[model samples]
Target: MIEPTAEPAVEARGLTKRFGSKLAVGGLDLRIEKGTVFGFIGPNGAGKSTTIRMLMGLLPMNGGDATVMGIDVRQRPEAVRRCVGYVPEQHLIYRWMRVKEVLWFCRQLHEAWNESLARELCQQFELSGQTKVRHLSKGMLAKLALIIALAPEPELLILDEPMAGLDPIIREEFLETVLQSFCRGGRTIFFSTHMLGDIQRLADSVGIIHDGRLLVHGSVADLLSRTKRVRLALERDELPAELPQGVIRTWRNRRECVLTITDCDSQKVQHLEDAAQVRVVEVLDVGLEDIFKDYIKGQREAI
Candidate 1:
């Protein structure tokens, strides 16, 4: 038996995948610590699903290696699968099956199925155990998928856009449930989503990817401190012709300009205001969405 403390919940080294002429995932290396929520932020068609599929052994890797729970995902995929709970971006259950049937099938396949856990999730999510998969609403279906993923009680959970089209209340409930599950320790979650608000509220660390490349990965506080959003109240109508080195994005309005600095110190921010001959009316903290935008813009400029 592999020792429990030997490896991270998920680790990928030089992971690459390609589709025809386009490279979907490019030589990516990832490490997800146990008991942490790692958010994957990227635009549509940025190879987020492709990477997750390869890790789950649903798709073959063109290059590199990945492991889940100390088992090689490519060589011993079944063992890796047994340790992972996955909620895909799209529904993957059989429409003809009833809720109970689906859960029973999962119970047969996974050694870690917890019947009590499934029942509790179903009750909390307000799902009908007897309802057929085809008859459930979109939110109910999403809830079912979550329950299935949690029922197994796997060591790691990989969710792709788990909050796609649900009501705000349901989304909050789902996030709370995930947090509750993680409280026990030694369980990790890797979630990919466009919902920046939920990411901000829940993520322990974030990884930003753009055009098949990772731009930045760090704690939320580290990212916020490294990036700045400054609103300058200027006497003049236009920004300075020469700007600082770390300014990533800038937008100008009448007698005012909002500047985004990617790598900024307090002195640099002060210098920018002074150089523009403006008074800093407000220097608000940057949110996850702003950081994501700056990261994408930086990536585009690099290409």
Candidate 2:
């Protein structure tokens, strides 16, 4: 077993997973530093869940290697689990148990469980001890899961689409909770979600995956700064089959060509417009989601 490192909270090298003939995650690699909030963003069936499961050791990988909290995931799965807190997309507690009963069960299993922190998170998450798991609303169930994940005070938090089915209000609350915890100190967060808005809200760094492959991965600031959505007004009734370098996606509609590009700025936009013989009508700043969408669109059209 590898000793826990003070630097990398999570690391993967050529991590691979498969189910039957389908490659769910393929040759995936990522490095999440300690105390960083790393968001994994992708559409459904993009291998995000499969990758998270691999990290949690809930599903075995077919190839490659991974580590969490510096413990080799495949070699010492139990040690890796000890230092990671996991929140899955769906509720998993027994329906018959009361909220507090589940907590008691978890506390018994984890010798390192901090009771004070557990109590604190229970209050913050507004979970009631007396309420049966069966009677909890979807939002309440989500909150309960968060409290359980937090109570352990694990060094790394692994969340798998925890906010997937939540309403905007609840999602906002969840984001707030995550942000508060992140600001507290020295904890690493690795989460996968289709909710790009949540990624923008909670992540310092992000990785984008699609069809068992990584599309982009880097600091959120760097990604947003490099990507842009540009709108061009075509003076001539012609559409070029190819656009200038860095244009990830371009499509003509009526008299305009809308495009998204990476490694672009104002000067580059001007140059592109001149080269393409189009007027630069608008150049818009984009978030992580827009960049991901543009890439996916480009990939689809290419195929």
Candidate 3:
């Protein structure tokens, strides 16, 4: 297990962005500790990419400040880029360049480029250095992009939907390679994706964003432990006038209702049972995916 440090690899304060009249990201504050695998999760067009771009200093923020590897992103973007490896959502490489040529070109840019690591990664991914970038398949392109990012031996890696579109087998293989090669070193990884399963598998901490706002951020264990699904078999056909305090969403039938709640415990359950006079059928632990869904659903309802 990778233990995080006191110093943050990435930190943002009241980060905001707007495109003319449209708000892309708004008042977002985030912190990612060193050596921690932090997953940035949200639905498509929920400002995940926008936030990442701002952090990478690729896009200018309209409000707030941020730092990457303790280098002020706004003032020293190039310095931040030097220390951070980023794989964008789109694989934007020269299509005409051969694999080896691409590697050589990137090697010239980064002072910390590791040739042996690059070669090893290429071999592991079954990439032929002779092949042109245009001829590579989608999975191969993804692999090549990752190889480029990893070859720099960066302190922090920021991946924006790196596994967006791939077969399950290929995705699993890619994730395994990432775990073996990158994560074992205790380097910080900040990746954004809508895939909950990937987040669950890769992240020690997760931040959920919706419609340009963060819903919650915490460790995976804390999230799973705090959020629960309470199944109740109601004594009568009707629900109580007021639901439980932490209830985010509720599903009901004639005789039963399931409450999706946060910060749930025995006391809260007992209180609900006493107030509503409903029998507690079960208090089940919720999965990460379900928890994410419930948060998203609750946010949508609020909007």
Instruction: State candidate 1's TM-score.
Output: 0.86
CA deviation > 4 Å runs, candidate 2:
1-6, 233-243, 265-282
TM-score result, candidate 3: 0.93
Question: Judged by lDDT, which candidate is best?
Answer: 3
Instruction: Show the lowest summed lDDT stretch of 10 residues, model 1.
Output: 1-10
Q: Per-residue lDDT for 181 in model 1?
A: 86
Better of 2 and 3 by TM-score: 3
Give lDDT for model 3: 0.88
Q: Residue-pair clashes per candidate, as listed?
A: 0, 0, 0
Cα TM-score of candidate 2 = 0.89
Per-residue lDDT of 1-303 in model 3, one digit per residue for the tens?
A: 545566689999999999999998999999998888899998889999999989988999999999898999999988888888899999999999999999999999999998999999899889999999999999999999999999988889989999988888778877887777664685888998878888888898999998888888889889999999989888888787777687887878888888899999888877777865586558999999999898888777666
Each prediction's whole-model lDDT (CA): 0.83, 0.83, 0.88
Tens digits of per-residue lDDT, candidate 2, 1-303, equal 123356598889999998999999999989888878899988788998889888888889999999888788998888887778899877798899998999999888786888898787778777889999999999889888887888778888888888878898888888888778777888889988887777777788899888899888888888898898888887776654456578878777877888888788777676765655675568889877678888888878878
Kindly list the per-residue Cα lDDT of model 1 for residues 92-146, writing each as its tens digit: 8999999999989988988778899999888887787789999998888888988
Q: What is the lDDT of residue 20 in candidate 3?
A: 93
Q: Give the Å shift of residue 155 in candidate 1.
A: 1.1
- Name the best candidate (by TM-score): 3
* Colliding pairs, model 3: none
